[model samples]
Target chain A: MILKSKVAGKLLRIMLISSIIFAVISLVTTFLFVYNEQLYLKIYKFDQFISVFYMILYYLLIIVYLVWLYKAHKDLVELNTMYPITPKGALARVMIPIYSLWGMWNVYSTMYDHFRPIKSTEKLGSQLKVFIPFYYFLFLITNGLNRVLLKSNTGLYEVSDILYLVSYSLDLILLFVFLKMVNIVMKALDLLMVVKQDIIDDTQDVSGQPKVSS
Target chain B: MNLITKIKEKKEYSLAIILLIIPLIAAVVMMYPKHEEFVATGDITSVEELGVEGSVYFTYVHEGIIENLYEKFSVSLTSRNEIEFSSLDQHQYENYTAYYETSDKYKHNTIVNAVQNAEVKTDSQTIKISEKSQKIMEKSSDYIGDSFGLMIAIGLIEEWNDEDFSQNNQYIISGTGTIEYDGTVGSVGAIRHKLLSAEMNDVDIFFVPKDREYYADKNFSNQVEAKKVVKEEQLTVKVIPVANLDEALEYLRKLP
Candidate 1:
C-alpha cells in the first residue's frame, strides 16, 4: 500500500514537471509567432513534431497516474470505512470530458479532507486547502474560454492569442499548486505511518509481547 | 492566518504569478508592428509611368562565328498591371525589382543627358522608351528587381538608338548585369543559371561583368564560374567579361 502511494506521488510529480515544460514551450512558440510571422511559421512547422511527441508523453503519464491513484484508493478503502467518493468514481470523474473539471475538484477536496488528522492539530491539511479552489477556478476559466474561443468567429487574433497565453500561464500555476499539494499529502501520510508504528512499538514494550495478526 | 503567515502562504503563488507575467510582457511587446528595412535600393521607372501596356516583343539576331549562320529569336515580354512577385522559387525577385525600378529611372535620365550632350535638334523634348517589357508592367502591381532583366532593357534601348533594323539584326547579344548612371555594369547573382540558359539557347557570345579580385569569392565571380560551366558542358559559345556599356558596345562593333 505504501509502495503504491509512493509510486502515485512520483507520477504526480512527473506530470507536474512535464506540464511546466509543455507550458513553457507553448509560450515560446506563441512569442515567436507574434514577433516574426515568417520566422515563426518556419519554426512552427518543425516544432509541430516536438509538440506531438510531448503530447504523447503527457497522455501516457496521465494514464500511469490514474492506475496508481486507483490502486492507492483501493488500499485506503481496506484501512478506512469513510470515503467521500469511491476509487472508481474518482478515476471516472477525471477521465470524462465535461465532468473531469468538477471531478478533479471533488477528488482533490476529498483527498485533502480525508487525510486530515482526527485531532485537528495537523497543519498539512490547511496548506493543501489554500490552493485547491484557486487551481480549480483557473482550470475552469482556461478551459471555458478555450471552448468559447473555438466556437466564436471573433477575428480578434491578437486578443485571442493573449487570452490563450493567459490560459497556459494559469495552467502552469495550477500544475505547481498540484505538485506542492501532492508533496504535502505524501509527507503527511509518511508521518502518520511513522506515528502508527511508534504506537505499536510502545504497546509491545508495555505488554512485553509482540502484536501478531492471524 | 496572521499577516506574516498569510504573506508566507502567498509566497508560492507570487512565484507562479511572476512566471506568468514574463510572457504577458513579451506578448505586449510583440503586439507592436515591426518595421522591415529594404536590403537593396536602386532607381527604375515603372512601365505605367512610361504608358506601355500588354506584352511587347524584341528580336535578337544570333550570328554564329564558326558555322557562318544567322538565327533570329523572337522573344516576348509579358506585362500585367497586377503587382505581385509570386514566384516562390526566386524569392529575391521582389527586392530585385525594387532596385531595378530605381536603376531604370537613372537609365532614363542618362539617355536624356546623352541626347542633350550630342546637341541633337528635335521638336519633342520628352525622351520616351517603348523599351518597357511585361516585367516592368507588372511592377505597376508587384515589384520585381533583377539586374539581368535591367541589362536586357538597356540592350533594347541601345538597339533602338541605331534605328536601322538591319544594323540591330547584325548580331545576337545576351548579357546580365545591373546598370549604373555612368553605364558601368555591376555584378549579378545566379551566374551559373544564366550561363546554362545561354548555353541551352546556343548563344554566340555571352557577356558577364568583369571579375574584381577583391570582390571575388569561391562561389561567385563571373569569369571563372562561366569558364568552369562552359568547359564542363563542352559548349562552343564564347564568354566575354565587360566592365561597362562602352566595353560591351566596343565588343559588338568589333563583331563581324
Candidate 2:
C-alpha cells in the first residue's frame, strides 16, 4: 500500500509494457542466433544489449508486481473491515514456500467473499473463484516440476525443454490475467467504498453514536 | 516552469526526477556501442583435447559489450586487467570469429588429412600414425580454432609412437598452433594468455609455433612471446618451438 492504487496501476502498466517489448526482442534474438549463426554474430552486440535490457525489465516487473500485490491486499482489508490477513502478512505470504498458495487463497477468497454480496462487484467476485486457485496451482506445479527436472541428470533433461515451454506459456497467460486482476481490484475498491458506507449506516440503529466517518 | 519557480514552490520534484532518470540513462549508456574484448580461460587438456584424436575449439565472443549485468558494471575492473581486456574491436571480433569458423571448416579437415598421411620413424621403422578409416577427430565446441591443429596432429602421433611427451613422461602436455596444409605449424594470436592457461592447467610441455616473419610483429613470434612469459614468470613448463608437424613428430619420437 506504499504506492496508492492509481499510481501503482500506472507504474505497473508502464513496467509491464516495457517488459513485454524487451522479452519479445530477446526471444527474437534467440531465434536469430539459433537459425542463422552468421547473422547472429553480425548483430551479436545488439543481442547482448537487448538481453541486459530484458533482465533489468524483468527485475522491475517483479518489484511492480509486489507493489500491486501489497496495494490490492490493503484495498481488500479496507473494504471487508475484517483483518483475515494484514496487508504485510499477505504480502510476505506471497513468497513463503509451502504456504504461498494457501496465503493467496485466504486473501483472494476473502476479497471474493466480500465482493460477492455487493451489487456492483458480484461479477468480478465470480472471476476470483476460478482465478485465485488456478493461478497458484498452475505455477506451483510448473515451477515445482522445473526444480524436479533439474535434479534429474539423465532422461528428464530432455523433457525439461517441454516443461520450460509449458511454464513460460502459463507465464504469458498470467500476464493478461494479472492486468485484469489489477483492474478488477481497482473497480472493487471503488464499488466496495459504497458497501462500507452502507455497513456504517446500518450499524447506527437510527442513532449517530455508532456511525463515525466522512 | 522555471527552476526558480520550483525552488520557491518548495518541492522535491527535482530530486525525484533525478532518481527516476538516472537508471534509465545508465541503461542507455550500457548500450552505448562499446567494443571491449574479454579473455576467459580455455581448456586444452580436459575432454578430448589431447586424446588420440580430439579438438578443443575456441569461442569468439567478439561482441562490443558483455554478457551479464554485473560484468557491465565492472568496466573499470575489466579495463585494468590485461588478460581480461583486449583491443579487439567489432571488426577484429568478426575477423576472429570468422577465423574460428573457417578453421573448423578447413583446418580441422586438413589436420586430419595431414595426420593420417604423416609418417614418423619409431625405434624400428617409419609408419603412418593412424589409418584413414580409424582416425576421426572429435570436435568439442561449436567453433574450432586453428591453434588446435598442431595438437590434433600430435595426439595421433603420440598414440602411434607409444609416446607420452609430458615431462619425464609424468606431467601433462598442451600447446597452441595451427597446422598448415603442408604440415607447417602456423602462429596464433594471444599466445601469452594461452600459455598462462596451459600453465594453470598444469601442462609440462607447451608446443608453440617457431618464429615466422609473416605473422611476427617486430620479430616477436608466438614462440618468443610464449618463452618470454615463461622465463619472466618463472613458469615450470618447458616451451618447445615446432616449425612444422615433422618437427613436432620428431620431438615426440626423440623424447626419452
- Against the true structure, whose DockQ is highest? 2
- What TM-score would each prediction reach against the true structure? 0.42, 0.68
CA deviation > 4 Å runs, candidate 1: A96-102, A118-121, A149-159, A202-214, B1-256
Candidate 1 to native Cα RMSD, angstroms? 17.0
Model 2 per-residue lDDT tens digits across residues B59-170: 1221233433445455433332333655556787677666645655665565565465344433425444444313344443443455667776666555556555553436
Model 1: per-residue Cα lDDT over A112-152, one tens digit each: 78667633316777777787898788778877876665544
Docking outcome class, model 2: incorrect
Q: Give fnat for candidates 1, 2 and onward, in order.
A: 0.00, 0.07
What does candidate 2 score in Cα RMSD to the true structure? 7.4
Which regions in candidate 2 have their CA more than 4 angstroms from the true location? Answer: A1-3, A17-50, A95-126, A137-168, A201-214, B1-27, B45-83, B89-113, B116-141, B158-171, B212-220, B228-237, B254-256
| Model 2, TM vs. native | 0.68
In CAPRI terms, model 1 is classed as incorrect
Local distance difference test, candidate 2: 0.61
Per-prediction DockQ comes to 0.02, 0.08
